[model samples]
Target: MTRALIADANLIKKVQAGEDPIGCVLCNQACLVEDVSNPIISCQLNPDAGYELEPTPKGFFQTRLKPTRLIKNSIVSIVGSGPAGMELAVSLAEAGFEVELFEKDRELGGALRRISNAGVGGVWCRSLTHYLARIENGRIKTFTDNEVLPDDIAQMAERGPLFLATGSVGSSCHSTMSGYHNWISSSDLLKSPLPAHQERVYVLDNKGDHESAWAVETAACFSDEVVLVTADPSPFSRLHKTGDLMPAISRARSLGVKFLTFTEMRAKGDSVEISKRFSPQRELVQDHMVIEVGARESSRLIEVDGNQTRQIFEIGDCFAPRTIQDAIREARCYSRALLELVAT
Candidate 1:
């Protein structure tokens, strides 16, 4: 409730005042657990959120980003335009680095772009990209729809430092049970909204996070019988870890979305099969299926080796798939490192 009020009511007041609200993302990551030990509790978007206090040991979260030593317009190549890459680009540019941003997609905002379509709280996810893009505008040179291949990394590194945040690829059980042709990712479904005529929709809650919940919510829009299948005993069980379990379940049930937990899906010849534990397996319908099983790091570009002349830093999901908070904070830390390195 407090987080919601700050993000909503307080944010509104700030906007009305014509102030840069900074838009509290309401992630509740920092303050939620800062008192336990070394305090890193601070806003992910705000670089100086905890500047008044002493710095922590630079864990998953980072704060107090200061690039006091300015560079002489040295070029820094940032690969992938996800939240992490965008944040790093803006951070480096602010520190006087000539930023060269690249994205394979047509636009910026890697996973957040697709995340925006998932369900509630999506608006902020999308806006975050816009916020970073706005800050980097005219400051960074962006190359969208341009993939930085493995071969291209060494070339870019030859010129300057490379920050690779190649993001990740979503996967589900459907990946192993291919050839059915109806299986699709929740993100892909959001990008290409499902047809209105769908009779039923099934979502594999492999993620058990907001994305999985978001998929079920999005699926409910087009199909009356939206079913969420999960291996966990309680569907969307992970939401409780972030203070959203009950709400997600309530919203999902209100939307007529059903749950099938402790269940597994299998490939039976040309068709897919599904059944709960200790239950008889039944052939599944050939309807559209949305999988929210999380993703693996996209590390194809990381295979190439770096040399003494140039340094290649893999940030965010490329380092290992994590939250947007981890992404932005890591970028902030790197930006500070970049300044210290090149300034000397």
Candidate 2:
């Protein structure tokens, strides 16, 4: 409806003149947010969201996102072969459309692969294999180690439907702080080799996600004095009733990983300045400082102007730095919409 209003000036005028829009802005209150026990998906705002399929009272629920064989010639260009991009590409390709997938990294699976390799085994890691299998099939034409530039977007836009799923990046304290001989982000630790360090390992848990805890776990295994400093009262607090946080926390504790909650930490040369909530600052000399705060959307799509294109859409982390579920949901919905365009 937002896109329709933008394209059709008369519709925008009608909406301004007290007319109702045709779409929901996906506020993710009832549909997205849910308890671990009852995974029944029902949208409070949009009744049509989960009404297409039979409602399951318990267990994991799947969507009715089957492929629609539309135009065989219409090529869909997808940037980033992550969950969102890969999901979208697979859907479109299965729908009898040619899909060209571009990934900046040499391999596929974006952040999903990174987390999976980080030894954070669970549903997330399992899901990576599923997505990888789907995209690795002969249906999608994938380009690895190819970062899509502005000129590339412009060229692809002229060809056919273009979607941007260029994921996100981990937050670093290097922007604010100085020194700390060895400084690494959560993603850095997850992907690259562990930096050379002695005893002290100070992990700055910023966002308090599962990734932070897993990174802390990895750090704890190597370093003797592993201290997790976080602003949140509890790490991985966002993972409501997932039954993942508590066990991981317990394991980290067993591994001698100390927790310092409600604290702010910054790197200062050879030492790190740590301050508790409403407390005076104290510097702790550490050999390694790993910062795991949060992630920001990749600016690849933002920098590239796709206005001149026929149909351009951005889904996943490129759209907003949300969960894997949110990215997959958005991709599925948008792909359905684009399929309609091909049908017309």
Candidate 3:
């Protein structure tokens, strides 16, 4: 009748109905059937589910499970709440550790959150929203708009192991001769509204990868003549899969976009000077120029105090620029390593 005793009845019913209930029944108790709908326990055989039941070190659950032991009351501090930091915090909390995540941005999700809101990238926005919801419901604590400095490491070290997952910085072209009225980095372009002009546009693919495609998609929405100029023979070669490249190329083609491979940009009045591979240089006037170069790690925190911190561990783009998948994987591996060290 009650929730605890219902399992017994179910077991007995299963056995009477010509079924082996041994595997189905978890508690080691003899079932006595008083009625088809109800059953009584004749003997309490296994107590504490095959282990000595004791209050965990954290006083959460009374069990000797390995997972519970690895986490009980352990304090973990994670800097940055991007995929890597957030995933690590959630994983640690689920294992029973007290986790606190710090983020510099006003909101979570890092670059993905900001870029996803840009037109034509709504899918990323939706995925990030779903992930943020899970983090909110979990035991992990998030502190936004808090930048972690090197001095902050000492404070976190006193509590538990520290994880640094600061993201990367966008690289922009600082060349003054590159002529264009509007020359903004990809990061800035993704955040701000496009400049007023819907006719001619030029996108410099200095990163030589999927970011080039992203720039093209964004510019295509506003420009009639959008050109993607890249230094690489195959501009999207850095992307891992061909399947991923197909859809982006298809979208650009549908918008009547132009791809200029092995090309470099120079300044020509209010327009851009383009030099194609094995072709004569020509001046092409454009309304906008979006530059998607590359990114470098922002490791200012780690370089403080002449790098005296010995326990310093850098995960995600702060150590090496990488994809979201790589960042999440590194965080998981780092958390597991920390748990193993504490257990021993």
Candidate 4:
């Protein structure tokens, strides 16, 4: 049977390689036959060395092998269910670890969710859903809409090593001057309603990032004659490739919004002084001035001493503000380190 299977595989390969007028010869079989149009050959011969065969979908023969590995039981706990947190938990659970994932938001995704709200599609959300499904099917636990305080970390540390994926918060942009009541952070705009606009408005783009551009666009929706001034050469340069900046630029142009590049605003009364990159300094009079900047890491939970009785590791934006890819990569590395320690 083995010899016959190998022979069939070789014949198929030869046929696939453009072998024409091929003929099959079998010995010592009264029922032996061959069909030239769709050749079929049967024979009973000695199996040869260095010969292998696999079954094909059409009841023919091919060559391949299925891969397999062993899974072991272990226990692991992960904090923050952003891409990083969720990815780590899923990977550990799939590797046979009893994994538990915790998230402060009612939803599992973190910054990815917020970005989606900016009219972007949810690619990470779909991927996360698939991973969470696997974890649930494997009996892993997920805690959502729950913040992990310092005490919570200590208790979880008692069970096993605790991995922190707490994520980051918006950075502060407190202007040096007083009574610049118009200054507001991009995060604040995202969480709360935009302030009532005046006839002429000035937006100070401190971050030169995408979220800031988003704030500017939102403000342009209601404000009359919005003027955006940024220290960077272009608006939302950091997130330009993500398709965040193009729409903003296009919308501002359509709405007759004026954009000033490499410019900084010094607000005074109903006017803001502007310093351009390569021109005479001038003042732009406006009723309001809005400031949009970037974010910073919020690692308060991990900062507290004795927060964890065992070894504690920090991952994701909690360490530094970064993309989802960075978060997942860190989580994977941390999980491997934990496995190595446990083995030792």
Please report the candidate that would top lDDT against the real structure.
1
lDDT of 3 by residue, 141-243 (tens): 8899898887788777556556787776554335432445567666556435676766677777766544566777777777778878777876555543323
Taking every candidate in turn, the Cα RMSD to the unseen true structure, in Å, is 6.3, 12.0, 15.4, 18.3
lDDT of each: 0.66, 0.64, 0.60, 0.56
Worst 10 residues of 3 by lDDT: 43-52
Candidate 3 stretches with Cα past 4 Å from truth are: 1-74, 118-130, 147-154, 172-183, 187-201, 206-210, 219-225, 233-242, 253-256, 266-273, 280-290, 302-308
Which model is ahead, 3 or 4, in terms of TM-score? 3
- Ten-residue stretch with the least lDDT total in model 1: 59-68
Evaluation by TM-score, superior candidate among 2 and 3? 2
Q: RMSD (Cα, Å) of candidate 1? A: 6.3
Order the numbered candidates by lDDT, best leading: 1, 2, 3, 4
Q: After superposition, how far is residue 153 of candidate 4 from its true place, in Å?
A: 1.8
Candidate 4: tens digits of C-alpha lDDT, residues 85-109 = 7767866775568778887778776
lDDT of 2 by residue, 154-175 (tens): 6786566678888665444334
Report the error of model 3 at residue 137, Å. 3.6
- Cα-lDDT of candidate 1: 0.66
Model 1: per-residue Cα lDDT over 1-344, one tens digit each: 45544333456677788854555565554435434675554555654455434343343111221232323444788888877888888877866678899988887777777666455554446456555645555478988989877777767765666778887654443354455566666545544545565678778776787778778887777776888888889988866656778888988989988899988775555666888776776656554554545534345465534243235677887787676667777787777655555545
As a whole number from 0 to 100, the lDDT of residue 257 in candidate 1 is 85
Question: Which is superior by lDDT, 3 or 4?
Answer: 3
Ranking by TM-score: 1, 2, 3, 4
State residue 21's C-alpha deviation in candidate 4, in Å.
Answer: 42
True-vs-predicted CA distance for residue 168, candidate 4, Å: 2.2
Output the number of the TM-score-best candidate. Answer: 1
